[model samples]
Each structure stands twice: as C-alpha cells, then as structure tokens.
Target: MQTRRTFAAGLASAACAAPFITAAVAQSATTIRVSTAAPPSDFLNRALERMKADLEAANVGIQFSVHPASTLFRQGTEVPALQRGNLEMCSMTTFEVAQQIPELGYFNRGYLFNDHAHLRRAFDGPIGEDYRKAVSSRMGIEILATHYLGTRQVSLRQKRNVKGPADLAGTKLRMPAGPEWLLLGRTLGVAPIPLGMPEVYLALKTGTIDGQENPLSIFSAAKLFEVSEQVVLTSHVVQPVFLAMAKPVWDKLNPDQKKAVETAAKAAATWGDTARLDDEKTIVETIKGRGLTVETPDLKLFREAADRAYTGADATKAWDLQGLKRVQSA
Candidate 1:
C-alpha cells in the first residue's frame, strides 16, 4: 500500500453559489492584518486568499492583508498578537488553544478524530458551538470557520521499520514547543525536542532531530520530503485548524461587515476543506517521486498507545469526555 496527498486554485470562491454582497455603500477600508505560519501554497492560505477576493468583490469596506510563512508573527505568537491588537486574524491551532483552555486539549489528542469529517462534525455542530463559546469567553477569540488539515504521520530522516510506538523509542522528534505537544511526544515513545517551524529544515538536515510529524500537506509544502527519507503513516491525528478573528475586532464590525466576513469565511472553508481532502488522496506519490519511502505502520498499535496516554491522567481529568463521545459518535 502507498501512503499518499493538491491545493486546487480557489481564488474566486469555493463552489459557493451565494451571490456576492453587492451593497454599493463605501466606507473607510478596515484593513485586517492576517498572519499565519502557513505558506501561500497551503490550502488554508489559498482559501483565505479566496475569501479576500470574495470580500473585496463584495464592495464591503474590508481589506484582507495576509502575511504568510511567519513573515508577520512567528509560530506560537499569533494568539498573543491577536490579544495585543497587532494581528486581526489567523488560523488557530488546537494545540495553541489548548494552552489557555486546558480542557479543550481533548482536540489535541491523537486518534480522537476518526477523520477530517468527524473532526469537522465536532466543530461545525453543537460540540463545535460549545468550543467556539469557550474560546470566545475565555480567550476573547471568535472562530469563524473550521477547515481540515491532513492526517498526521511521522516523517523520519532515517528509514526504520516502525510497526508500533516502541519502534520509535529514543528517537528525538521535533514537536511544537509546548507541554501538550511534548505529551504527544511521550505518547509516541520519542525524545521530544521543542523547535519553531522555521528551524525544522536546518535541524533535520543537521541531524538535530531524527524526525517530525505533520499533515502530508505540510510535509510536501515545507519540502520536508527533500530532507526526510521515510514517512511512517501513523495517521494519529486528523487535524483541523480554525479561521479565527479577535473577539473585540469581530464585535466592532458593522452588521453588514460581519455578514460579509462570515460569508467569506464559510466559502473559504468549504473550498479549502475539499482541496485538502483531495491532496491527502494523492500527495504520497509526489513525495515518493522525490525519493522518500512511505510506510504504513501498525495503526492499531499507534491508536492504542495514544488512548493509553490520556486515560486517568490528572491533566486531562477536567476534559469534556461527553463532548468527545459526541464527536466520536458523530
């Protein structure tokens, strides 16, 4: 079996039939400072760009200035940037959100989401509404939409037959610098090293870490395929990132502006989600062409290991198990 993942061009709008908001009234442009660690090539960015196009075409007094690839804010800084009024929007990660709202950490747990669809179900429906409220109340951020990031897999610089969690023992794995992600490192039986995104490539090339894990879309877009020799498809986390805006900023918007933003976000998510799902279906072959060996590990073993890591843990004692159940059943 081949482990594989395209960001289809989503400039105008994503399969959205809703007519553009055509209010002819013009006001001072509200320039939203969008920042992301994702490259312009990322499907999320493409969708955001598409939303920007839709918003601009709507004649809404909105200017979406997207700063991609950490040009504006480095990884782990967007949340604060939003709070400080330095940034207007970003694709918020569960890992970062869990930092402040600890119980929300359940979303960061591996194997919790059956797939992208299940993940979205939790966020798009009642459970997602609950999450949005929690974030808005506790952190002052408003979630506009949720989009799929591909399933996570382990990409290593050295080829090894990784059939189970133990196979990765003592392997230094690079994870986002945080207690939560480091916890995931321990679950995978790896020596976790905390590093920023911009430093990963040089670290891999310099042997500072043995491997890293991310969605295949990220792996390909970052060109990690060029540095890593193998990909072990653990498929642990079916990741989803949120399109978010600062709560105060969102509140300050006029009714029509708010409607335009919401409409654009919805259109963007719909387009980006479909593109990402398609990318996951075909990306492995592209990486393999660059001389990477894709391996399917014992996924059952991996899932069981992740489940064991969270059970009866004091840190997760306050988690919303019922909500998790709802997401699982969804």
Candidate 2:
C-alpha cells in the first residue's frame, strides 16, 4: 500500500551505458523514497530530482520518489525514519548525524573546513572511511557522496553593523536544533533559537527571529532576502551533506541496482556542487540586485571566537580531535 506513483523501468536503450533487468523479468523493483527539507527551488532538491530521472531513464529496474519541502518528514526526522525503515534515502547533514553519533561533530565544527575541496579531501580520505563505518554500523545508513551547498553567511532581518560577535549579543538567531548548531550560534554571540527550515520564513517575517545563516545560494533560493535586510559574510563553515540511503534498503538491492544508485548519487552531487560553486561567484550581486545589503565583517574576529568555542566549550568533548587534525591536514 505504498500508493506512491512510479513508472516501470523501460527496456535498456542504446543510449544507456548498461542494461538492467527488464521489468517483465524482474519482480522486485523497489522504489527509493527520499525525504528532504529543501524546496523545489533549492539545488539540493533539483539534484535529487535529476538522480531520479537518471535512474528511471537508465532503466535500472527501480523507481524513485523525491518528497521535497519536508512534505514526507519534517526537517530533523528523516534520519530516524530511515533507521525505522519508514524512509529509503535522504540528504543527511553532519549536524544531524552528530546528534546521534557525537564524535562526528568534528565535521560540524565552526571554521573546521577551509573550502569545499578541503571538506571533500577530509571526507574522501581515510578519516571519512571511519565516519562511514560508524554511521553504517550504528545508524543503518550508507553514504554515497558529499553535497557542497556553499559557505554559510548571516542573513538578518534588520540592516546593521555586525562587526563582531559583541555586535549581536541579544539577537534571536535561528539555528538548526542541535548542540553543534546552537553552539555555533552562541559562538556568534546570538541567542540561538532552534527552528526547522520550513518555519524560518514565517518566523523571520513575523519578527519572531532576528536572523538566520545559510549559504548565499540557499538564501537566494529560499527568498530570505524578502524578509531580511542584510547578509554578514561570515563564511564560517563550508557545509557538506551526505547523500545517504537506508542500509536495509541497500541490502535489498541487487549489486547492479546498488551500483546504479551510487552512480546516480555521485552524478547528482556533482551537478549540485558545480551549480552552487558557479552561483557563489555571482550570487552576492544577485542578492544586491534584489535590494539587500551585503556586508563583510572582520572574519578574523569571528574565527577567534569560533576557536574559543571549539576548544573551551563542552560540546567538543565528544568530537574526534584526531579526525579534526586529519581534516586540517587535508
């Protein structure tokens, strides 16, 4: 009683790189159900859609259903759903994974990654293998590839001079609910408010939240500029999300289908990464065209505060410092 609409895989055409078992001969074509909080406008969702189309078009003897905008599960619930066998796939953030496996919080730390390349090297190297094993062993999930969304910057409801953390002591800022995000919010010297992605716009519009932070591309796609006034270019953390699938679901897939899923996931991640990197080059001007003020605060002061937060705070007690060093070396 899935009731989810999907197409049967067509015969593999000459256009396809490999042939899949035809639907007529295959009795176990499972549908991969993906849940994400990103809206259709966000590149993450678009990349998921592309992955769906790719698999279907390749006649991979499987189906894909991408439920965007938290329509399937709320922002923070997809991981649990995947663990419970209620979901098949998702883009799980490091912050969410660290919530369950605290040691992985190293990846979610502020100023930990210098750029997307550094993040990728850290993840693609041996350090990342340990993390993959931990998540798979404990969470019943298998990660496919890294999705680089872009660097996070502060988007405020009111235009002001945010020279340093002291400039925003009482500001009510929305951070994704987790010690990692909340700790970073406190490091930025704001009253960290936990809010889901879907609720951010209304909260900002209603003046319930003073500001939020995300990549420039997401800020533009989410239309936060409509409700906000300025963006502080903190460039705090280069965000990376894992294209993860339930291990149970993966175990059910034949080797061919598993390979297909991995291929599509990596291709989609590349699609998103390329688009976001290209967008970052000009999105500053794009938002400015929409009449939003973009400011570059002294990132040095912000980095110093973040250093103190990582070393002096209790949250880092569970972080993998060895892995942190490996990532830094990467």
Candidate 3:
C-alpha cells in the first residue's frame, strides 16, 4: 500500500510538469512590454508605473513592464512599431501617430475645451468613441484609451511682451515636423521651422527660433525656461496622448487580461491627464519664481487662428466636429 501511494504521488507530479514542458516546446515567450516617450521623472512616467502596479496586482500569470524614452523606437516611431509588432504596446502622442491615422488628431481640432471637465466629457462620450473607432478601423491598431497632455501654449526665448495674436505674426517658431503645423504657422503669418526637439534649446539660444508651442510640462522637462524668459498661454489645442497595443500581442491576451488592460488604460489616461494640469501650474509658478514673465495672451484670437487654419483640411473631418463643439460650449 505504501509503495503504491509513493508511485501515485510521483505520477501526479509528472502530470503537472507535462504542461510546462509542452508550453516550453511550443513557443518562446517574452514580457508584455509597454513603451512611452516621457523620461521616468515625468507624470506620464508615474502613470505608467501605476499601470504596472495595477497589472501586477491582477496576479496574472504573465510578465508586464514598460520601456521609457523610446527605448524600443524613436519618439515618433510608436505607431509604426505597433503596426509591425516590434513592441507589445505604447502610450504615445497623437502627432506621432498622425501619419498612420489622420483621425488620431481628432482631439486636437480647434480650441476644443474650455476646462478639464469639458475635455473629459468629450473624450469619455460620443466624440472619443467615434475617434477610437476611426483609428481602430483606419490605422490597424487597437485604441485602449485617449488622454490630454495639457493645452498647447507659446513659450518664448526673449522678453517680448505678447499682448495678443498679432504678436505671433512674423515670429520665427520651431514647429513640429508636419504640414498641419506648417499650415497653423502660416495662418498666423509666423515663419515656422521644423526642428527636432533636442535642438530647440540651442536654437533658442542662438536665436534660430523665437518661440515654441508645447504643454508646460514639456517646456519644464526640456528646461526651455533657461533661455525662454516668457510663457504666453494661448491654450491653442489640447495635446492628445493615446495608449495602443500591437494587434498581434493584443490578440494573444485572454479575456480577463484584456479587460484588466483596458481598465488600467483608462485609469492611466485619467491619472496622466489630471496630473499634468497640476504639474503645469506648478512648473509655471516655478518658472515665474525664477524671475521669468508669464501671461495669458489673447486666447480668443489664437482660437480663431487655429480654426481658420484647420478649415477644409482632411484631418478636420476625422474629428466629430459637432460633438467637439458641444463639449467646447459646455
């Protein structure tokens, strides 16, 4: 009886080990890697950290992690990487994905939101839903959630007191590399130059450019205030960030894992978006405390300029314009 019991225990152990052996024989595996453009010190970084915790808290039987500062791909290469399945997932800017899906710019159209509440409503409601569908269908990528990186405003190098939109006319600015941004500059009669982000500080120092448009966190992270003594808040557009996963990796997730990821995505989006607002105010005050001048210029005129520039562009229709207008009014 004792000998038979020992044999039975051995048999049970062998049975449990069989699955691992088969799985090992079937395929090689890797951690589910998520990438982001922000350095580890930024709020986006913190949000990703929270996501990692939430996913780990799930106690799921899989490896999950994040790669920061484009370790997997360059800053703008995020969506293309998603298409090729070079990486598992990413949380990136809309402009980075614009080439693949023009509709990804939906959240950026016009002066879309009066405040954070309005912005959240638009994204959590019909406008955000439509935008997600368009990207999923047109871009061949999955949209987990969309978020705001804070409002775009002008940060200037020299102490030119900007009282209104007319101040931007003839100002040479370093715009992101794309036609839409060029059109935006031309609408205001500003000479727009496309320069890589790393080059902006030296460009400002050497007087290569007069100003730049970015959310306050970006300006602070890049230390733009060292050369740029003035910050003019125009709130021209809300910079949109998206969490996306490669279709292949997305397909491999079990139903429960998929639901957990989706839930974490929404939570991360909300955390990153709201935390950015707080960071923006803190950074602006810090810059001002260092003796820099900050002002909220003619926001109305700036909005009009953005509207005039975006009119008739193919990218404009990708956004549910009526829905956005309702949110704006709300």
Candidate 4:
C-alpha cells in the first residue's frame, strides 16, 4: 500500500482533478448582468453607467452588463429572476417587488419622508437593514442599497384639478400593478386600472383610462403630458428604488470585491437621487411652460387616506404604525 507505484497512482488522480477545480474557480470571474425597468435615459440608468465605469476602474474581472427597459427582465420579474440565478443584479422600485414581499411596500408610503436627509437617515438605520435581511432570507436576494427614485405626481386627461378626494371620484386612474397602489386608489374612491408603463399613454389618449399616476420624469419622458396635460402636485407617494444583487453572485465575490461593489452602489444611488431632484426642478418649469395646470391640494385628506390605508390590511408585516411614526418623527 505504501509502494512507489501506489503513490504515483494517487498523484495521477490528484493531477486529473486539478483542472476541474481550476475551471470552477475561473467560472467565478465571469460576467454578471444587471437589469432596470427604466429607459436608458433615466436617472437611475445613468447611475448604472457610472457604476460600470467604477467597476471597470476597480479592475473587477467580473463584467457587469446593464440592461435597460427590462430587456433582460420586466419589473415584476426582477426578484424571481435574481432568485432563480437568471439575473445577477437589478434596480427596481420596492413597491414592484412588494407584491411578493409585502413588507417592501412600506418604502412607497405617502409622505413617509419629509425630505431627502430624513429619508437617508431612516434607510441607513435599523429599518433598512432589517428589510435587507428579510429579503435576503425570504426572497433570496441581497439589497445593496436604497434611494429615492422620484416623487410621484398625478396626471389627468381632463382639466379637473385634483384639489381633494371628491375630485378624484369616478376618475379612472392608471396605477402600477401593485397592491399598495390599488389600496391607494380604493381609498380615494377612484377606479384603479393596473397597467404597464407603455400602456399608460395610449390608455389616456384612447379614453381607456382617465388619468395616470407617475412622477414628473415618467410623465415627461413618456410625453404623457401630450395626452394628459393636467398635472397635480399630489406628491401622493415617494418612489423609492432598491438596488439588489443575486445572493449567489454576491457570495462569489471576495470581501474586497463586495466592498467595492457596495461603495459603488451607494455612490450610484447618490448620483441617481441628485439627478432625479434636478430633473424634478427642470420638469416642473417645463410643465408650467407647457401651460399645464398643476395644483397643490389641501393634502390633509390625501394624508389621512394614506394613513388609514396603511393601517388597514396592507399594514400587515409591511411596516408598523409605530415604526412609521418614528421615521416620520426623525
């Protein structure tokens, strides 16, 4: 058993397996794809471009290919794709994924953050960390970071100003296909038609839907103002974006690589947030120049309705009344 022939046989076996181990290690350095539902010109899309540059400079052999407008996957497919290892990363609205994980919808709550600073603090604390862990455990994804995507504004086909809840009655509101949006529409007593983004403009033009809820960036980019010129500053909900990576992809990275990606993601989020705010200002002026009637409602009724909606069935596990109160307080 201790003969030279036996030792040589064992050596041959070990040598045969060496290439397989090396090949497995080499596969870890392969490309990773990231998807976004937004168009190429979107603020978050631009941020992804920056992230690509940073990753390049950092010499991350792991290539990152950014797919815009859901080329790789749709908004609803983000979590599932990442979980199933079909996609490596994604940037999406939390509410979009909240359909599967209800707790994520809290990030979309109306008037949840008074300003950008408050939002950053709340998200950088225990609440955001908890959310990330919950998703990692339940949804099988790693949330690298979260940021304000955009501020939602109301757009209508008619000239009726949305000054209060009464004005919204009987109006067909196009909301993203999500439970929270449906709840918001139900609370306001409007007929909510859950539809995709591309279908929104045509619906408004064809009278299929009376109006749609979106931020200034979306309305302007989609040229919804062409069909629905009336813009209301309901600021109904704050659009929050979460940048998530597949857990398997993340696990493959060395600690240093993970840190670099994390830093780059946070930087990208900051870039996106700043870009969105600047675009908001520009779009506001542009909408005014277009002679669109933008109204600032009393906001009291909308706030109350949103609070009640959150306290209703939608509140279960998504967020706590007290936690939201603490966030508001902060």
Candidate 5:
C-alpha cells in the first residue's frame, strides 16, 4: 500500500512540474539577438531597452539580448550579418541600404524633407511602405520602424563662419564613404574627405580634417565641441535609422508574436523620435555654453543648392523623381 501511495505522489509531482518545464523550454527556444552601432547612452539604445521591456511584459516567450556600440558586429557589417542569419535584428541607417539599392538614396538627398512633420508623413505613409517592400524583396530584411537620428549640420574647427555653401568651398570636410554622401559634399561646395565614424574625433583633434557635419546631439555625444570651434545650422540631411529584422527570423514568428514585436518596435521608435526632437532644441545652447560659436546662415542658398542636386541627372538615375515629387507635395 505504501509503494502505491509513493507512485501516486510521483505522478502528482510530475504533473505539477510539467508547466514549468514547458515554459523553460519555450523561453530557451526563442532567444533573440539584437545589435546596434550606437553607444549605450544613445537614444537608439534607450529605444531597444523600451522594446525589451514591452516584449517581456507582453508575456511573450521570446528573450532579447542586446549588443550595442558594434560589440556584436563591426561597423558597416550589421546588414550583412542580418542577411546571413547570424543576427536577429539591428538599427541600421538608410545610407547603408542605399549602397545596395541606390534608388533608396533619394531619401538621403539634401533638404528633401522640409520638416519633421513632412518627413513623418512621407515615411509613415505610402513612401515608407514602398521602401519596406523593396527592402524585404531585395535585401531580405524586414523594416519594423523608422527612428529619426537627427538633422545633419556642419561643425568646424578653426572658428570659420559659413554664411552659405560658397563659404565652404575647398574646405576639407569629413563625410561618410558613400556615393550619395560624396555627391552631397561636392554639392555643398566642400572638399569631401571620406572617414569612418570612430576616426572623426581624432581626425578633428589632430587637424586631419577641417570640419564635419552631424546633428547637434551627435556632436555633443561625441564631445566634438572640444575640438570644434563653430557650428553652422545647415540641417542639411535628416537621417532616419531603420529598426530591421532578418526576414527568416521574422517569418518564423507566429501572428501574435509578430504583433507583439511590431507594437514594441513602433513604441520604441516613438520614444526615440520624441527624445531626439527634444534634444535638438537644447543641444545647441549646451554646445554654445562650451565656447563654440553657432551660426544660422541664410538657409535659402543651401535649399536652392539642394533643390538643384535633387533634379540632377546623377540623382535622377537612382531615384524616382516622380515619387520624390509626390513626397514633397505630401
């Protein structure tokens, strides 16, 4: 009778442990790895944190492991890693995508977006959907959300005041090593010197480059004011970072899992967008407080130059001018 009682007890214990064991297995099976080139303090990283919190709160069995500041993959390799199925997700720039899909470079065109509202309409509307489709079909990556990085502006080292594009003529400016960026530098009347992001600080400090262009937040984050003497509010290019997942990984998600991820991604992007917009307002004063001269030139000249670049044959070769016109009108 004691043996039968013990057997009954064993069955009861097994039954009690089954749910726990199943949950553990489910959690282990759904681990996700997300990578980004942004530092831990960056808005992009903060957004990822928000995403993690939301996903976990939804009681999804998935687990998120974040790697920031290019820890998991080197700079410029994130996209390739995602394509190869070596990574689950990443925050990538449209410039990187433009290298493969040159037509996508249209979005990077100088002064294409009039303001944040215009940009939001274009991206959150049909243009965004079209680009997402193209990226999924051509690159095998699924775009979840678009997060604003910041508006690009010029930061100079020698206290030179730039009133217009003409003032930047022959000035050696650090630019990203991409065709569109090269063209932009040329259009803006600067001698374009291609450099990596990690090298910009040392390049400025050592006088390897005369100036560089980036949003105020990036300038402050890198503490570029220490080396930079002046800031020109060019607001040349409005950069948007893409929150993307490998198509293979995205395809494996069930409907509910996909919905959870999408909701989290959009929420995180909204957080990043709001944070960046707020930062843009205050970062200029913060930079000025550090003894850097700030200038707001007649943006008319720069805008005209940008318009010329947009309609040029080179730009037209890669972009759908009609689509661009539609975005502008929208």
Candidate 6:
C-alpha cells in the first residue's frame, strides 16, 4: 500500500511541475540591442522606447536594450558594425549608406525634396523599396522604416546675414566629412570644412569654422545657439532618418518576431515623424528668443545653384539624375 501511495505522489508531483516548466519555456525572452547617435531625450530615442514597449507588451518573447548617443558604436562606425554583424540595429541617416553606394547620394542632393510630405511619399512608395533592395544587396543591412531628421539650415557665429549663395562665398562652414557633404557645401559657395560632431562646438567657439549647417532641432539639442548668433533658414536638404537592422540579425528572427519588429518599426517611425514636425514648427521661435538672428534667405538662388552643381556630368555619374527627377515628380 505504501509503495502504491509513493508512486501516486510521484505522478502528482510530475504533473504539477509540467505546467511550471512549460510556462518558463514559453516566457523565455530574446533580447536585442539597438543603438542610436541621438540623445535619450531626442525624438528618435522616444520612438525607440515606443518600439520597446510595443514589442514587450505583445508578449512575443522579444525585448530591447537601447543605447543612445552613440554609446554602443560611434557615429561613423555604426555602418561598419552593422555590416560585420557586430551590432544588431541602429538609427542612422541615409547619407551613411550613400558613402558606400554612391548612387544612393541622390537622396542627399540639396533641395531635392519640395517638402516633408514629398520626402515621405518618395520613401513610403516605390523609391524607398528600390533603395532598400540596393542597401541590402550591397551593404547587408535591411531598412525597417523612414524617420525624420529635419531640414538643413545654416547657423553662423554672428548675425552675418546671408541673402544668397554669393554672400556665403569663402565662408568656412563645418560639414560632415564626406564627399557628398563637401559637394553640397561647395555648391552653396561655402568653403566646406569637414569636421566630426564632437569637434564642432570647440571649433565654432574658437573660430576654427565660421558656420555650420544642420536641422534646427540638432542645433538646439546640441546647444549650438550658445555659439551661433544667426540662423539662415536655407532648408537646403530635407533628409530622412532610417531605422535599420543588420541582415544577419534580421535573418535570425522567426516569422512572428519579424512581424513584431516590422510593426514596432512602423509605429516608431510614425511617432518620430510627428514629434519632429511638431518640434520644427516652434524651434525657430525658441532659437530666436534665445538671442539668435533667424533669417529666411532667397532660397530660389540657393536652389538654382544646387541644381546646377548636382546635374553636372561628374555628379550625375554618382547619382541617377533621371531617378532623382522621378522622385521629385512623384
């Protein structure tokens, strides 16, 4: 009788433990590390938080560890890291990809986008798909969604009013160290001084560079106003930010996980786009209130100059002029 009782107790214990074991297995989480160059308070980081929340709430066993402000990988290194599978994901600008695939530089061409809506339409439609395929094929990274960076503008050390490209001639403007960026600055009649982000502030403060161009949000976030006295509303380039994943990491995801990631990416992009647009509306006022002279220059002259520079034979060799025209019309 005791032996039978013992066997019954053992069977009961096994049955009780089965549910716990199954539950533990089902709850196992997959952690993904995502990195961005933007700070935690930036819209991009907020979007990343939204993605994390949605992914975790879905109970799909996926989680995210976000590293902001280039903590995981430095600004320029993100691309190479993603290519080598050393990093899982990054929020990066399309210009980073253009460095490798020169044809992608079409997106960075000055004054190419008429407005934010035009830029979004191009990305959400066929043009974005074509670029995504090219990036995957050449760089081994998959673009998840398009996010807004902001419109590029020129900020100067003093209230040096620039009415046209002629006024900007010989002015040393700090730009990202790249052929495309240099070409853009040169086309605008500025002597482009290639500098990294970290060096910008010190360079500006000590008069190493007379001016720089970036979105107002970046200028505000980086506290560039402290050094800059005037902001020219050049709006030379309306560029889009990209959420991308290393192809190897993306390939490892199962169908359900892939769906979760895609859903989260789209949501994050929407959130980021809204935040950026809202911020742009009031950022100029905020900057001006901080004692900066904001001017809206004759953008027509700048646009004409950019068009002439980018349509030349050498420039067209790097970018598809016809494709660019199609995007503009689209």
**lDDT scores for all predictions?**
0.85, 0.88, 0.74, 0.78, 0.85, 0.86
Q: What digit string (tens of lDDT, one per residue) describes model 6 on residues 170-259?
A: 899998877788889966789999886657888999999999998888788778889999999999988798889998888988899999
Write one digit per residue (lDDT tens) for candidate 5, span 172-229.
9998777788888865879999986667889999999999998777777777788989
**lDDT agreement of model 2 with the native:** 0.88
All-Cα superposition RMSD per candidate: 12.8, 8.0, 4.3, 7.0, 3.0, 3.6
What's the TM for model 1? 0.89
Worst 10-residue stretch by lDDT in candidate 2? 1-10
Give candidate 3's error at residue 220 in angstroms: 1.6
TM-score of each: 0.89, 0.91, 0.81, 0.84, 0.89, 0.88
On TM-score, the stronger of 2 and 6 is: 2
Distance from true location, Cα of 259 in model 4, Å: 2.4
Order the candidates by lDDT, highest first — what do you get? 2, 6, 5, 1, 4, 3
Write down the RMSD of candidate 1 (Cα, Å). Answer: 12.8
Which pairs clash (backbone N, Cα, C closer than 3 Å) in model 5?
A: none
TM-score of 2: 0.91
Q: Write model 4 residue lDDT over 1-330, tens digit each, in one string.
A: 569989999999999999998888668675778888776777877888888888878876667779887777866777778888888999856675566676456666777777667777877888777778878888778888786777777788888866777788988998877767787776565789988776777899999999888778867877788997688788776667788898888988988789889988899988889888888877888997888888888788888776676675634455555765667776
Residue 56's lDDT in candidate 5: 91
- Considering every candidate listed, which one attains the maximal TM-score? 2
Enumerate clash totals for all models, in the order shown. 6, 0, 0, 0, 0, 0
| CA error at residue 37 for candidate 6, angstroms | 2.1
Model 4 pairs in collision: none
lDDT of 1 by residue, 129-220 (tens): 98899999999999999888678888999999888999999999998888778878877878999988778888999999999988889888
Candidate 2 residue-wise lDDT, 132-180, digit = tens: 8999998889998889978999999999898998898899999889888
Top-lDDT structure, candidate number: 2
